[model samples]
Target: MIRLTGITKQYATKGGMREILKGIDLTIKPGDHVGILGRNGAGKSTLVRVIGGAEPPSSGTVERSMSVSWPLAFTGGFHSRLTGIDNLRFICRIYGVNFDERLAFVKDFSELGSYLYEPVGVYSSGMRARLAFAISMTIDFDCYLIDEVMAVGDDSFRERCKVELFEKRKEKAMLIVSHSHRYLKGTCNRFLLFRDGAITEYEDFEEVYAEYKLLLEEPQKF
Candidate 1:
C-alpha cells in the first residue's frame, strides 16, 4: 500500500511561491487501478512526480510499502550522452537486476535495431520513448506510475504496450494519468480528478468523466 498525507507541492514564481498540489491525501493498495484526470496546467504531472519520488513535495509524506515504478517511459532520468544499452545496464544495476538478462527483452520490444548501441541523445523522441517503455518493463514493480506514456507510438505499438502493462501485469497496482476517457474507463477501477490543486475521487466513471468534459467545455474555468 502507498499512502500520501497532506501532500503539498510548491514552486517559486516571480510573484511568490505557488502551490501546485494542495494538501492532497490518497492511499492506493495492491491491485488498485487508479485513473487521474485533469485539465492542462492543473498540476497533474507535478502530483505524479511527487508520488513517484522524482520530485519532492513541499510538505507531507509519501509512504510506499510496495515498490513504485517511476512514471512509465519517462526519460528525465536518462543520461543523454550514454548509449541506450549503457543506460539499460545502469538502470538494471541500480535495481540489482542483471543487465544481460533484460537486454534481449528490451532490444526486442524497443525495435531500435542497431540504434540501441547509439547515444540516447541522437535518438528521435519516439525512439527514446520506446526504449524507456521497454526498460520500464524489465523490472517487476508492485505499483506502476503511468503518465501519458501510452500516448506514444503507433496504434500497433500502443496495443503491445497495453498488453504488456494492463494484460501482463494485471495483478499490480497502477496509478494512471491520461486524457483518453475511453481507455481509462476500460482499464481503471477507480477514478480521481484534479481541480485547483485538489483531487477528488468519484465512485462512477461516467459521472466524473462528464464533469471532466464539462471542465473542458468551460471557456476559462479549470
Candidate 2:
C-alpha cells in the first residue's frame, strides 16, 4: 500500500515561487490500477514524480509499504556515461537481483541490439525509453509508476508492452499518467483527474473520461 498525505509541491520560477501541487492526498492498494489525466501544464508529471519519490513534495508524508518501481521511461535514473548494459547491471545490483539472470531478458525485451553496448547518452529518446521499460520489467516491484512515455516505440512494441505489463503482470498495482484515453481505459480500473493543482478520483471511467474530454475542449473553464 502507498499513502500520500497533504502533499504539496512548489518550485521557484522566473515568475516567482509556483505551486504545482496544492495539498494532494491519495492511497493505492495492492491491486489498484489508476489512470491520471490532465491537460498540458496541469502538473500531472510533477504529481507522478512526487508519488514515485523522484521528487520531494514541499509538505507531505509519503508512506510506502510496498516495493515501488521507478517511473517508467524515466531516463534520469540512468547514467549517461554508462552503456545500457552497464546501467542495467548496476540497477540489478542495487535491487539485489542477479544481473546475469536478467541480462538476456532485458536485452530481448529492449531490442536495442548492438546499441545496448553503446553509451546511454548516445541513444535516441525512443531508445532510452525502450531501455527504461525493459529494465523496469526485469525488476519485480509491487507497484509500477508509468508516465506518458509508455507510448514509446512503434505499434508492435507498444502492444508488446501492454501484453507484458497488463497481461503478464496482471496482479501488480499500477499508476499510469497519460493523455491517451484509450490506453487508460483499456488498462486502468479507476481514474484521477488533475485540475487546479489537485486530483479528483472517479470510479466510473466513462463518466470521468467524458469530463476530461469536455475540459480539453474548454480549457478556460477549468
Candidate 3:
C-alpha cells in the first residue's frame, strides 16, 4: 500500500518560492491501477517522483509498503561515456545482482544486439527508450511507475510491452501518467485529476475527462 498525507512540494523560483503541490492526500493499495492526469506544470511529475522516493515533499508524509520501480524516462541518468550494455551491467551491479547471469536476458529483450556495445550517447531517443524499458522490466518490484513511456515505441512494440509488462504484472500496484484518456481508461481502474497544485481521485474516467477537456478548452477557468 502507498499513502500520501498532506503532501506538498515547494520549489525555489526566480520570482519567489513556488508551491507545486499543495496539500495532497491519497492512498493506493496493491493491485490498484491508477492513472494520473493533469495539464503541464500541474505537479503530476512531482507527485510521481515523491511517491517513487526520488524526491522528498515539503511538509507531508509519503508511506509505501512496496518497492517502486524507477521512473520510465530515458533521461541522462545513465553515463553517456559507457556503452548500453555496460550501463545495463552497471545497473545490475547497483542492485547487487550478478551481471553475468542476466546478460542474455537483457541483450535479447533490448533487441540492441550490436548497438548494446555502443555508447548510450549515440543511441536515438527510441533506442534509449527501448533499452531503458527493457532493463527496467527485468526487475520485479511491488509497484511500477510509468511516465509517458509507451507513447514512444512503434505500434507493434507498444502492444508487445502492454502484454509482457502491464498484463503480466497484474498483481502489483501501478501508477501511470499520460495525457491519453483512452489509454488510461483501458489501463487503469482509477483516475486522478491534478489541477491548481492539488490531486483528487475521480469516480470514473468520464468525470475526469470532462474536466480535462474543459481545462484544455479554457485554460484560465480550470
Candidate 4:
C-alpha cells in the first residue's frame, strides 16, 4: 500500500511560487488500477511523479509499503553519457536484479539491435522510449506508474507492451495518466479527475469520463 497525506507541490516562477497539486491525499492498495484524467497542465504528471517518489512534495508525507516503479518511458532517469546496455546494467545493479538474466529479454523486447551499444544521448526519442519500457518490464515492482507514453512505438510494439504490463502483470497495481478515455476505459477500474490543483475520485469510469468531457467543454470555469 502507498499513502500520500496533505500532498502539495509548488514550483518557483518569476511571479512567485506556483502550486501544482493542492493538498492531495491519496492511497493505493495492491490490486488498485487507477486512471488519472486531466487536461494539459492540470498536474496529472506532477501527481504521478510525486507518488512514484521521483519528485518531492512541498508539504506532504508519503508512506510506501510496496515497491513502486518510475513513470514508464521516463527518459529523464537515464544517463545520456552511458550506452543503453550500460544503463540497463546500472539499473539492474541498483534493483539487485541479475543483469545477465534480463539482458536477452530487454534486447529482444527493445529491438534496438546495434543501437543498444551506442550512447543513449544519440538515440532518438522512439529508441529511448523502447529501451526504457524494456528495462521497466525486466524489473518487478508492486506498483507501476504509467504516463501518456503507453503507446510508445509502432502498433506491434505497443501491443507487446500491453501484453507484458497489463496481461502478464495483471495483478500488479497501476496508476495510469492519459488523455485518451477509450484507452483508460479498457485498462483502469477506477478514475481520478484532476482539475485546478485538486483531485476527485470516481469508481465508475463512465461517470468520471462524462464529467471529464464536461470539464473539457468548460475549461474557463475550471
What is every candidate's alpha-carbon RMSD to the true fold? 1.4, 1.9, 1.6, 1.6
Which of 1 and 2 is ahead in TM-score? 1
Separately for all candidates shown, the number of backbone clashes (residues 3 or more apart, or on different chains) is 0, 0, 0, 0
Model 4 ranges off by over 4 Å = 220-222
Cα error of candidate 3 at position 54, Å: 1.0
Candidate 4's error at 12, in angstroms? Answer: 2.1
Query: Distance (Å) between predicted and true CA of 3, model 1?
Result: 0.5
What lDDT does the true structure give each of the candidates?
0.91, 0.89, 0.84, 0.91
User: If both were scored by lDDT, which would come out higher, candidate 2 or candidate 3?
Assistant: 2
**What TM-score number comes out for model 1?**
0.95
Instruction: Estimate, for each residue in 91-197, the C-alpha lDDT of model 4 and write its tens digit.
Output: 99999999988999999999999999999999988899999999988889999999997767888889999999899998999999998867899989989999899
Give me the displacement of residue 158 in model 4, in angstroms: 0.3
Predict model 2's lDDT versus the native: 0.89
Colliding pairs, model 2: none
Error of 2 at 33 (Å): 0.5
Estimate the lDDT of model 1.
0.91
Pairs with backbone N, CA or C atoms under 3 Å apart (clashes), candidate 3:
none
**TM-score between candidate 3 and the true structure:** 0.95
Worst 10 residues of 2 by lDDT: 213-222
Q: Against the true structure, what is each candidate's TM-score?
A: 0.95, 0.92, 0.95, 0.94
